[model samples]
Target chain A: MEFSYEVKDSYAEVKADGRLNMVSAPKLREFVTDVIAGGSSRIVVNLENTAFMDSSGLGALIGCLKAARQAGGDLRIAAVQPQVKMVLELTSMDRVLNAYASADEAFGND
Target chain B: MTEVLAERSFRGLAEAEAIESVHDELDGLWNDAPFVEAMDQMTFTTAVIESASNIVQHALPAEAQRPVELGVDISVRSTLLQARVSAFYAKPPLGQLEPGTPDEDSESGRGLALIEALVTTVTFERQDGTNIWILSKSPQA
Candidate 1:
C-alpha cells in the first residue's frame, strides 16, 4: 500500500492508497506511529482510496487508535467506502471510532 | 503501490503484509453500487488474503528474502465472487500446515481456520515448488 500524508488545518490526514492486510498492516501501524511521533495529535485516516481491510489490519487500526487516544489524541476515520463500512460495523468498530462522510467532516469542520 | 484494478498479480510473499488490508480493500470493492447490499466479494477477498499470508509467514519464512511469487484474480460469475491466489514459496515444515495450538488469545493459528470458514471451497496444489491456492466463495444470495 502507498501512504500519503498531508497536514490539514488541524489534523494530520493520512491517505492510504492500496490494500491493507497481513503484510501491509505493520507498515500501516509503523507509519501511523511515525506520524504520531512526529507530533500530530489529531489523525484523520482517509480510507476513501483504500479498497480492502482484514482482521490483522483491523487489529492494527484499533491498536493505533488506542495508542493515539492514550497519548491524548484521537484517530478518526473519513470517507470509508460502504464495503469497508460493513466490516467495521460487523466488528462494531464503527461505534468505537468516529467515522465521517469526508475528511473535513471528520475533523468537525462542518 | 499495487493498484488492484479488477484484478492484480502480487509477485511475492513479501507482499503478504498487504493482505492484512483485505478487509477494508474488499469492502471498498464491494462498496460499488452494484453490490450495495451484500458481502459476497468481501468474503472471498478476505479468504484469499488470509491463505496467502499463511504461506508467506509460515511456508516461506526462511526463504522469504528469496523470490516468492503470488498472483491474484477476482471475478464475479452467477452472483458469486471468486478469488484465485497462486503463490510460490519454500514448502512448509512437515507439520506447519496442520493447524496450530495457539492460546485463545493468540492470532497465530487463525489464518487457515479463517480462510476455511470464509471460502466455500479451498483447493491447494503444489507443483514445481509453487503452491497454488484457489479460494472461492458464494455469499448468501
Candidate 2:
C-alpha cells in the first residue's frame, strides 16, 4: 500500500491506496504516527482506494487511533470500502473507529 | 460430491509476501466463478486471507532447518466455496483453538473470531507436521 498525507484545515488527510493487509499494516501505523507527531493529532485515514484489510490491518488502525488520542486529538476513517466495512462491523470496531463518508466530514464537527 | 468449477492454489515460504500471492489467487478465483454471490465472495475471501495471514504471523517451524511454508488451496463449487490453509513444517498450534474476547482498544486477537464469523464452518487438522485449517462457506444462490 502507498500512503500520502496532506494537512487540512482541521486534520491531516492520509490517503492509503491499495491493500491494508499484514504486509502494509505496520507501515501504515508508522506513517500515521508521524502525522500525529507532526502536530496534527486529528487524522483522517481516507480508505477510498483501500480495497482489502485483514485483522492485522484493523489492529494497526486501532493502534493509530490510540496514538492520536494520546496526543490529545482523534483519528477517524473515511470512505471505507465494502471489505473493510465488513471487517469493522464483524469485529464490532465500527463503533469505536467511527467511519465517515468523506475526509471532509470526518472532523467537520470538531 | 459437487464438482469444483473454479480453484486456486499457492505454496511458498510463510512470509509477508505470500499473503499478497494468496490474495491475488482469490481475486482470480472470483473472476473464474462470477456466478457466486457478492456477499459469499466477500466473506469467503476474508476468511481465506485471515487464515493465511494467521499462518504467516504465528506459525513456528518445527525444526531449525525446516522453515514453515504457507499453502492455500481454494475451490468454488456450484454452491460452496472452500479453502484449505496450511502451515507446513510447523509445530502443532499451542493451546486450544478458540477465539479470544478482546476489549475494543486491543489491536490483535480478533483474527480468530473474525474468521469464525465469516465462514460457515471452520475445522483444524494436524497431519504430518502440518497445521491445516479448512474453511467452508455455502454461497448464497
Candidate 3:
C-alpha cells in the first residue's frame, strides 16, 4: 500500500491507496502515532483509493482513534467507498468516527 | 485440474475492502457453482477476509518484506461447498476472540464468531510457513 500524509491547515490528511489489511494497519498506526506524537492531534484519513479493509484494518482504525483521543484530539474518516463503508458500518465504526463525504468536508468539520 | 478465476499475491495487505472483494467474487461464483451458497456467504466471506487480513497484519511483525499468499478453492456436491484456503499467518488464539471495540453500534468484530456460526464446519491448520483453512458450507435445511 502507498500512503501520503499532508498537513492541510489544522487537520492531518493521510491519503492511502491499495489494501489496508493486517500487514499495512500497523504501518498506518505508526504514521498516526507520529502525527500525534508531533502534537497535531486532529486527523482525517482519506481512503478514496482504498479498495479493501479487514478486521485488522478496522482494529488499526480503532487503535488510531484511541491514540488520537488520548492525545486530546479525534480521528475521522472520509471518502470511504461503498464496500469499505459496509465493513465500517458492520463494525459500527461509523458511530464514533465522523465520516464526511470528502476530505474537505472532514477537515471542515473542525 | 482446477480452474482459476482469481489469483493474486498480496503483500500481507489484506484489509476489509479486500475481504469485501473476496465476498463479491464468491457471490459471483455462486451462480456458476454450488460450492458456496447464499445463506452462508456473508459469514464465510467475513471469516476468510478477517483471517487473511489478520495474517497480513500480525504474522511477521519482525519481518518487513514477507509476502502473504492467499489461495482459494471451491467445489460443489449436492449444493454443499467445500472451500479450501491456503495462507501464511499466525493463528489467532483458540476458540475465543480478544475483545475489540468496533463501535458500540457496529456488529463487525464478529468475524470469526460469525464464521463459526454460519458455516457447517470450520478448520484451521498451521505448519512450516503456511496456514490452511477449510470451510464447508451447506444450504440451510
TM-score of chain B of 2: 0.98
**Native contacts retained, all candidates in order:** 0.22, 0.97, 0.16
**lDDT tens string, model 1, A4-106?**
8898788899898877677667888899898989898689999998777765666677777876777788889889986567656655567777889888888
DockQ category of candidate 1 = incorrect
Q: Better model by TM-score, 1 or 2? A: 2
DockQ of 2: 0.95
Q: Give the number of the best model, judged by DockQ.
A: 2
Candidate 2 residue runs with Cα over 4 Å from true position: none
lDDT of 2 by residue, B38-61 (tens): 888889988998999999989999
Cα lDDT tens digits for candidate 2, A1-110: 99999998889999999999999999999999889888999999999999999999999999999999999999999999998999999999999999999999999888
Where is the poorest 10-residue window by lDDT in model 2 chain A?
A: A29-38
The candidate with the higher DockQ, 1 or 2, is: 2
Distance from true location, Cα of A103 in model 1, Å: 2.3
Error of 3 at B23 (Å): 11
Off by over 4 Å in 1: A107-110, B1-39, B60-117, B121-134, B139-141
DockQ of each: 0.16, 0.95, 0.13
Q: Is 1 or 3 the stronger prediction by DockQ?
A: 1
**lDDT at residue B87 of model 2 (Cα atoms):** 97
